[model samples]
Target: MNKRIFLSAPHMGGNELNYIQEAFDANYIAPVGRNIDEFEKQIKEYTGAKYALAVSSGTAAIHLALRVLGIKDGDEVMASTFTFIGSVAPILYERCTPFFIDSDTASWNLDPNLLEEELSQRAATGKKQPKALIVTHLYGQCADIVRIQNICEHYGVHLIEDAAESLGATLNAQHTGTFGKLGIYSFNGNKIITTSGGGMLVSDDEALLSYARHLSTQARDDAPHYEHNEYGYNYRMSNITAGIGRGQMEVLSERIKRRREIFNLYQKELNIIEGLSFMPELPSSVGNRWLTTILLPVHLSPEKIRVTLEKENIESRPLWKPMHAQPLFRDAKGCINGTSDTFFKKGICLPSSSSMNNDDIQRILSLLKPLLNC
Candidate 1:
């Protein structure tokens, strides 16, 4: 069998083990350690946020963000429909109602026009607007965040960016996760940079992050005795994983660059093929290009291509199914215009790991090109 081609495998920097060894030498195996502190520091420095909290996973970060924003108990929270479940799962955890917004052809992220219209309609009717909007930078690409942020501000809605797939992505000159009230980034095994598993919540508000830090550590009161004024999750990131993150941070820019190169290679190779087009980055933005996605022709299905690649031990996947289309969200409210649903049906994510080489891409194209042509 041919070697396996993963969608987005972890590509480690050379210094990961050195940091891990330092953590071990310090005997800081617990959550509260130098590694965790340094990891959070690195995130803040990189993302230009005033504060950051390293947590167990991206979902935990989102949950803490919602809690800090005081959005709960049936409060309406708006979100981008064309994203992974982790991006919006915390809304349910907080018992907040989610009103999903569809993507647009311009950025393949949330549609700002739809958002403006919805918020305007709500205001006109004297209807209660959503308390927050969780917008994802889909596939490491920038959402139209600046416009979205402006709209959210106009409507008195908090914007929480889901930059899990876009650690190094930028819109104009600003990083993605920093555009909103609170943003979260994932360092899962398959991300551009991996800490095995971890996440970071960033914000300009120091008090909010400090409160989230308390909540992440179980919301224990700072007393001599183990006392709790309120409940919170044990969502702290470990020193070991943070050690990995510290090293990952060292090479994040390089990883993003290589990923973009791979994306360019895919575009150069596949553009000539009829009815297939690569995902676009806005003229004013630069994406990490985490996974080079393509929208196939109407005659070709993403699933069929995914299955065919699986036969050759090459990994591929369909685009995210719109949240409103999920059975779990059948009763949820949404301002849908079929954009996300269409992308979901026709899009496929190709293997675009930073570790890939020209030969590896050729292997994929060798199989993929034939399928598309046929």
Candidate 2:
């Protein structure tokens, strides 16, 4: 049997150990240290965000975003129905009502037209507008962000970008996360870059970022003695973890390059199949290609493909199930366009770890092509 091929394994750069060692030597084992500062700095500079706050996980960042934005219980928060659970879990944490929005065939992301319609209809009917919209950049591809941002502004809704899968993605040469009021990036084990498990919250608003920083660290009031005026979460990212992030940030461009290369390779190999389509990128946008996802024909079940890959000691998986279809969200209000539902059934996320080589890709195509009847 061959070595196990993973579905987006972490690929570490060589400088990680050096940064970790430096942190250790300074005895900065806690969450506060140079590493965290540097990590946040790099993220802010790279994404063109004015400020950034490192937290325990991407979910924590989203929660903090909600807290800082003053979105509380019973507030309606709109979200992409086609995203991973982490993107919407924060809405639940805040005891807010979630309104799911379906994806579009063009970008496989939150539909801007639907969003505009919902907002306009609500306005005409004198219904309360949702406080915010949490739109996920699915599989690292940029959503129609500029148009979405315009819609959100016109509707007086806050935009919280769930860029967890799209750290390096950009639209019209502008980073995806910077377009929204708040944006988050994940450093989970399987992300394009990893610090084992961490997340960063970014925003152009300094006050919001500062308040988020305060809330992230248990909302402690500034004083020499231990003090707290309001409730908060212990969401700080450890210095040790930040060291890994600093190193990873250094290699992010390279990682995105490799991931895109891998995607192109898959496209070249798999486009020969009669009934397959790769995830599309919107014009004027460059996605990180965090994972190479494809839609399979009705005859080629994603489950069957995943199982066959697993049998070969290779890893693969299906795309996210629409949040509206989930049992928890069964009663939630949504623009039910059936696009995301269709994608959920037919999509497969192929192994796209930057560590994977051309040979690994060919091996995958060899197994997949037969099942696809190419």
Candidate 3:
């Protein structure tokens, strides 16, 4: 048996323990501490956001963002159908009705054309439009955000970027998350960087973020005694986790570099194979390449390939099943095109951990080449 390879796994910088030790030394073990403050500051600086609030998870950040935006029962919220449930679950948490949009063939993110169609139809019917549009930067790739932003603005809808898998991604040298009203990042164990489990909500609007921070910490009114003015959630990131994020932030650029290198390596090696195509990279966007994904010809079974890789102790996974197809969202209204369904059927996520060296990459290729007949 060989060492198991993961599709995406935590890659820690050597300095994580130093920050953890500092947290211990300062006795900042709770969610509120210098580490938390510093982590939020670093995220703001990195993403060019005016404010950031660290929370327990990316889903929590989304929930807080929706709550701060005043989403309520029966309010419509539009989200990309081609994303993890984390991006859509928050809408339901806010008691908002979800309207899903399909993906563009090129960027594999939300399709702005479909978005316009949906919004235009809603406007024509004189019905209330979605309160917000949650655009996900899936697989670290930036969506056509400039176009999407224009559509959202035209429709008078707030945009929230789900940048969970795209922390270091940028478009025309601008960060992906900053173009929207609010954006969120994840630092889960399997993300580009990890804080074990944490997320950050960022925005240029300080008042909104201040309210979000208050709400995340149980929405207590300013008083010495325990008091609450409204509904709140225990969603703050703990100091210990923030310490991990602080150290991970120090090495984020390098991690992005390595991940991209991994993507390039995989493409260079496997793309020559018949029936295989790598995910397209847009010229204007620099993606974090969090996971190297490929599309196989219809004849090749992605599940079979995944099983073969698993047998070799290498972890591979099918691309996210479009949310519209999920049993949980079966009844959710969606503007449909066949793009996302096709992607779901043929795409596979390859091992792309930044810790993997060239040899590790070669090992994976060697195992796959025969199976793929490259």
Specify the highest-lDDT model's number.
Answer: 2
Candidate 1 TM-score to native: 0.99
What lDDT score belongs to each candidate, Candidate 1 first? Answer: 0.93, 0.95, 0.92
Model 2 quality (TM-score)? 0.99
Error of 2 at 366 (Å): 1.0
Candidate 1 deviant stretches above 4 angstroms: none
Ranking by lDDT: 2, 1, 3
lDDT of 3 by residue, 1-374 (tens): 99999889898898888888999999988988988999999998998999999999999999999999998888999899999999989888877889899998889999999999888988999978888999999999999999999999998999999999999999988898899999999999999999999999999998999999999989988899968878799999999989999999999999999999999999888878877888776778999999999998767888988998899899999999999999998899989898999999999999999999899899899888887876
Assess candidate 3 and give its lDDT. 0.92
Report how far residue 52 has shifted in candidate 1, in Å. Answer: 0.7
- In candidate 3, which residue pairs get closer than 3 Å at backbone N, Cα or C atoms, i.e. clash? none
TM, every model: 0.99, 0.99, 0.98
The residue pairs that clash in candidate 1, if any, are none
Tell me the spans in candidate 3 whose CA falls farther than 4 Å from its real position. Answer: none
RMSD of candidates 1 onward, in order? 0.9, 0.8, 1.0
Question: For candidate 1, lDDT tens digit of each residue in 239-345?
Answer: 99999999999999999999999999888888998888888888899999988999998899898899998999999999999999999899999999999899999
Better of 2 and 3 by lDDT: 2
